[model samples]
Target chain A: MASKFETPQVRKFPIIPKLENSATSHLSPFKSKEEFQSSLGYPGELVENWQEKAIDKMGDLLGKYRSLRVYLDSCIQCGACTDKCHYYQGTKDPNNMPVGRQNLMRSVYRRYFTLPGKYFPKLVGAKDLTKEVLDDWYSYYHQCSQCRRCAVFCPIGIDTAEISMAAREVMDSIGVGQKYCNEIIGKVHKIGNNLGLPEPALADTLEGLEEDVLDDTEIDVKFPLDVKDSEVLLVTPSADFFAEPHVDGLIGYAKVFHQAGISWTLSSHASEAANFGMFIGSYDNMKKLAMRIREAALELNVKRIVFGECGHAWRVAYSFLNTLAGPFDFLDPRYPVPQHICEITNGLIDQNVLNFDKSANDDMTLTYHDSCNVARASSMGGIMGGQFTIPRKIIQTVANNFYDMDDETIKEKTYCCGGGGGLLTDDLMELRVKGALPRMEALKHLIEEKGVTHMAAICAICKSQFSKVFQYYDLELDQIVSLHQLVSNALIMNKKEV
Target chain B: MSFVTILYAAMFYFAAAILFIGLAYRVYEYAKIPAPLKIPTPPAPMTQKGVAIRIFREVVFFESLFSATKWTWLFSWIFHLALLLAAFRHLKYFTDPVWFWVSFELVQVAGHYAAYLMLAGLLGLLARRVFVDRVRYISSPSDYLILVLIIAIAGSGLMMKWFPSDILAIKLFFVGLLTFNFSELPSDVVLLIHLSLVIALMIIFPYSKLLHAPGLFFSPTRNQVDNARSKRHVANWAKRMESTK
Candidate 1:
């Protein structure tokens, strides 16, 4: 099984350094640019030299000291991930290839930032800064939807999406960020969400949506906000107030909570979980925006935080909340636990408090589209496995047809909807549509060969991207619906509660 | 200095310095790109388990490169391999004896054929850049300029090898210069051309994308992994909810 021609080994790190408190005491456990380089024997003087030139270097220093540095020092670029990314599969342009995309920002970042870099530039293929390279950085970094699907395929877990985010952040630090990414981040800072919708405007939008639900279903449903002493604080993406398929998912979350009799209220101060700041690699911005949600929850005295179906927001909730803002006491030790809508539905089912009639969606065969963020980068997926249990269970209870996509189409290997990392922007629609090819190719196969009629998605972004892909690919529009949409349609809600 | 030595030294100092110096500048420029360092950097390609498979696909088999363009790969492979051989063979001057006995055979063959191949490859790459609209569109002044200088270096090197010249004396003159002991030198026109081209390469080495060779190791793409879950495992507002400390 082994061919003889082999490459030399990289110098292995000795446990001695990690064990020696005298030398390694300063090393942080998590990945940090400063720690990784310091471990790599990079002299800190290189950074100090640059700091001397620039008076306003504190922010840059802290940013570099954070986990970003570890991410910067570790990529080897074996190109094994080429076939793993749905974007690459969709658009076969070598530029879109994950490794090539990572290199677009990475190679240049190394020369200016690392130690051996200052001495041996050519040995590493580092080039000097130019306006042209910056331009290329923007074009390619944005080209990444930040879908972590490729991460699922990496051997050592190199996440190309992280590279794209870091590239955008570096550009933003240098005042070179895209109008789209930076503007959204600014709005998230100034207002509550990327749309810059204030509390009054947000209330009006939700009240308007409640009225729409009443008109459609003849049921009076209120979307509550900023109520004190609630057991749960629910946060939804700002997109839900205006966006279509996402609105249905939001409605689905509301109904699931309503049916379960959970005391929850939305917080206008922290209305959205779609932290676009994350996409730009601004950890401070992400923390600032996310902290507001924490503040609202603490002030509201909620027992738990139920996050609506938003991708990156969920990622932040699941991945970063504990580390940056941790050891919560005001919250029930178990309180402030963020739950996916499916999790709530699944919880209701497990408690035997929910009933279902699958006949409503029986006309079509349903296939689930796993959102890239939830599937790869977060643990909420197990909840999906739990929550999605009900729709099928209800379908079986009512004798409806249910099927699945290809083996690779489910779980961690799920294809991205091609609009992740906020490519749903009008400016990026062409790129999004182009990048959707690989995922669509797989979906098209299911639609045509496997007789898949409806694609059930849990995340709002997936619903949005799938709808666009369905439209472009000339598939049925109604076929793409959120799991909640199906739940609302098929749930056996008590007539008295309605 | 003899006319040949002076002319060769003058030209090589100019050409090699321009080429290599410009390249160094380019490398530095690449490092200055506005990119954050949060992305993960992986280990050396040689360190990974599937490295052999990857090397086969990437370097030897030319899988993706072949798909990009057959001719680009052809020129690139020939240029890289010949340049590597030339560099290794030049090690003959650095040590008492050449350490790469295996590669020495390839270097001997290169001494015979690398000059013409490099000229052809560089010219082919240069022409392809000019004639092919796509490559031309991406090709910068430095990219084309680097190719021209490389052609000159290989050509001068081949010319010296084929022609009977006091190359040892010329080599010693360069050694003395490197040791900071510049003195009288042998008269050789071709050696001067090669030296100038080599010098030109050194000065410009820091300014280009070629710096990516080192930058790649520092790049987050090779290092960072998708560990968002490890960070996000806690519920929102857990601090406020708990806040015991």
Candidate 2:
């Protein structure tokens, strides 16, 4: 797992290397327990005749999800996506390649479903659903960040992310699930958030945040929780409650809400925005998790809903929430069903309602890293390219020096932070570090050439990922800053009097 | 009626039947499958008209491949475009007096160059699979064989064009077959080989990776609009779940 190739001093595109055997086969996440698996409606253990069950599930999925069937049948192996994956680029493993990873399940799909593969498996590169094949699927599929980078470049739009998701769903149905995602999902079901920070702890955290904001500025900005009849219910990731930089972003949201005189409260029932069900590819689980927001909104009678900084969460909310828990007729129809906090702040900025003393961020030169989910899965301002522009617009408005990385590495072409798609656990540390190579290389270029002292990201996962993986490249952990943290630093609270 | 003509007429009919029926079944399967969620790669088009234009650009221009790697795109585009021209030009054999468009001098000239380009493009693509480390690693035997098969078909066709085989007999044979009358077929070795290879490609089209032709149109991630928030997209099974709830 060591850096097999020379670390490029500046960011460059990943070149195809000679394929190595077992480059990452040793990497696998801890398996979930029986209770954890059953909690999410999966089997307690590997079921009897799991092969048949897995194949049946694959067939069920093929019927239920059109993307799976199309993608499975469509690949011509032209290798357009061969070098598109960050893990393959970093690991030099053919299995990490998008097509290679997909074939882990695609091969079995071929064997059981296609006539040629059923008759002549070896000729078609198809294999039976053996235990070894299942283990490989678990390993390689987890390595993918579900970023859809390869899907963008594929001629037929064969998304490996869809294949990975289907494979995970199949595994879970067979009583094989990743401990990190399944356990977190169980926590969300039992308690309200992944952290299991109960109502008292959440109240305690908000109290500390409110005191901190007042200590910094004379104005007492409120961080309300479970307050009924609030105009807006803010749903943010639990990491923002405790983690540095993320916590600063949380405080920034509070100040923005205070300055705008908007009554917003966080729902303890739906305290966290991150949805691990999306990572594990379970629609039932994802929908169950998403339904909490709708329930909380109706119960609290909030007119609107606004989501905080979380990558995949925003994707689920922006792209899947309406279908999962819809008919939000009780809420305000004037706003976007669930507006992104960036859009809210940007709207306020556009209205000249919020003031920023840009010089407050003079200590830093910054570049924005677009989270994969936000960059590719959802948009802001209901326009194309809004996702890419809205965050950078906010950053430039708040900070003095903002330079973008190479065009190829930004916007829709952005690399995953490597810790996404539920691979953020310590069990997959090597994959996380190596997978961070592409984005890290981009950051290194900005640091050396553009005087980019810090990189701001909207997602909590990207912030946590860069903070941990920066050490491997001899970069400081503090180099990863939150976009709202920058906004927090620059906002002039006393501007209303001026 | 010659024995060779009868044999070829029957072969073409069988191959065409398999190709059409098989492709139709596969396409129906793809179309019937429910897309439970909205997952279009963004910045996706918002309207149905926009998505159609997007797919048209992808099919005609290979836009995604053009952005991915210029080398693959160049070879793939040349092969596909030239293949289209070469196939269209060959329509003269099945039509009596030929379609008016095929009679154009420009079309005739383009067809000749297209055949040459097709051969050149196939060879370049085959070379990439052979030499490129990443491509070579992922290439199965069928992948390489598919390329070799196409190269053979193109090579044989080019030989007949350059050597001036019994074109009148070949055209009469195809035209007679279409009209349910048999004619003496060309016994020229190159023409026979070319016809056999073309028949094989058609028979194998639906069963093999050639399904990508239809699969591209059905791909949900590429074809769906990025308007999940504005309009709810619930699949049939998802609707059933709601009803049960």
Candidate 3:
């Protein structure tokens, strides 16, 4: 289907686009309906005293989160982060610029919370919390993917993600929640996962997966669900249970587990690893979601908890899990509380437990797209930049030809997949396609220069996003492959016992 | 004491009070609020010592800014380094027995020339705010005025070298203020203008974006240690929520 919005032309060399005033001002996500809003404990709709409530929420968040308070106060308007955002680069809307998006709420913050802004608002660029300003917050703040690429470049480490998240939180508190994030969060609360897959349905999906693997690999690689006394509890995103390319990665996890001879089971209780609560900046909801995993781990008596392939899921698992639902003194203390699947696969590859037939992936020359959250927000193997190396190591072991994209576009400087931090819904398809411009340009460069056909990603969002966006850029949809799907292809599941 | 002496002394005292007290309050608020999550921008250091080194590199070298854009880093670094040197040189006036380093010939010569570099840095910053479309779009009136204010201060200070002021009386006046002894301040127009702008910067330091200096130390993204997995980080507010669970 042709995109309703114009797709940004892939540039040969990336240049900062000229600022267009309100270029994407009309692209706000659908607001949460009454049921969706209240299910997450927010008001049903725009509250009667939303203005006062929003300012009060802002004041409360400023006190509660040091990141929100310090970041709002610390921006020097230096523009180091201006061209750093994919949204800004694609849309050319000044408001999509990290500083511009921040100034939306920062202006309000100054007006209500600072002394000078209280007296001389215009001089300091502070504005009253008017309807127009609040609308700008909703439209522009959603445009941000909370990627933190801007933070890596900021002089004072002023994270625009923190600002946008707080803006979202303040909006939700005043009954102005976005439908996509709020509804997903509500599903995770009521049902076990974002897709609202019930326990029996989850088991049925796993069973179908087991049969599919048996039909292909002719091995009894078990995709266990709710099996007590298992050695490991695998809490993957619900999308992995059914979505294309993601489900293949799930099969790869089963194959690896079978080969390594480590027993693992999925939890019907804490079925989701992608916590939308973090996207909305609700600590309460985030902790509640995190605690479900903790409860599952304790109830199943698992020795280790390993998260599957998801970007922000791994971030929450790697970074915030311990803080949110920790002292997992109950689980084995030797392992990291929640380890990443790539770390496990890489470890097995190092130990020579899982042998790979490198020629199995010889049909395509491959490149890796570092998902923004996993690359920048979280780490692997308890070492700096391990998140980058560990995944590449796994791919290199499994594939004969593996290449990386542009240096600046890969490691800690990696661009967002345009669908992360809950901006992946179909309603925001235009924003997603436009936001993918920077990443697409880099991928286009590799495809032309290096004969790269497939771009592998560990993030479910990245995979799904690329699958949709590749067609827009005239690349094949199948060009986007799961990192573990490559593993599934190359792994010698039935090696001769020698 | 002449009226100029008492008026300047009172102004100095008030400015000093605002700078210190206001800074303390802002710092206190930052320190009091707990960072509930571990959100260091990676590849961040994994230990406390490594995090200290990370923050030190950020502050002393403007490492992240350098990685971002060379132009911003060059202007900002030169401006900050020159400001520090000039502040160090001013210590000679305030101290009764100037420290050996402050009295050193190299310090005196370098400090005098630091004003030119300071002005150059500020001008470069101001030029960006005006010329760069991205920077100009974000630049508020106060952002421009702050740069201009500092430029004027440095310009007026540099002017005193050619249109000379009473250096000896200025030193004695500052020393007298320190020792609680009233003395006359030379009412040089340039010196008065310079001092007035300096006082204005001090009064606005805590309230303005000037807080980015001390605020950098409190930034959770820069200051946080990347040991969230190994060590469970819990804040007081979060702890209450956990207890209810």
Q: lDDT per residue, candidate 1, A371-449, as tens digits?
A: 7776655654333233334444533443366676666656656677878885666565555565666566666677777
CA-based DockQ, model 2: 0.81
Q: Give the fraction of native contacts in model 1.
A: 0.08
Ranking by TM-score: 3, 2, 1
* DockQ head-to-head 1 vs 2, winner: 2
Q: Select the stronger candidate by TM-score from 2 and 3.
A: 3
Candidate of highest DockQ: 3
Best of the candidates, lDDT: 3
- In candidate 3 the C-alpha lDDT for residue A329 amounts to 87
What 10-residue stretch in candidate 3 chain A is worst by lDDT?
A489-498
For model 2, the stretches where C-alpha displacement exceeds 4 angstroms are A1-14, A495-498, B162-165, B243-245
In CAPRI terms, model 2 is classed as high
Candidate 1 is graded, for docking, as incorrect
Which ten residues in a row are the worst by lDDT in model 1 chain B? B37-46
Model 2 lDDT, residue A191, Cα: 91
lDDT of 3 at A82: 88
Q: Which portions of model 3 miss their true places by more than 4 Å?
A: A1-3, A495-498
Prediction 2: B-chain TM-score: 0.95
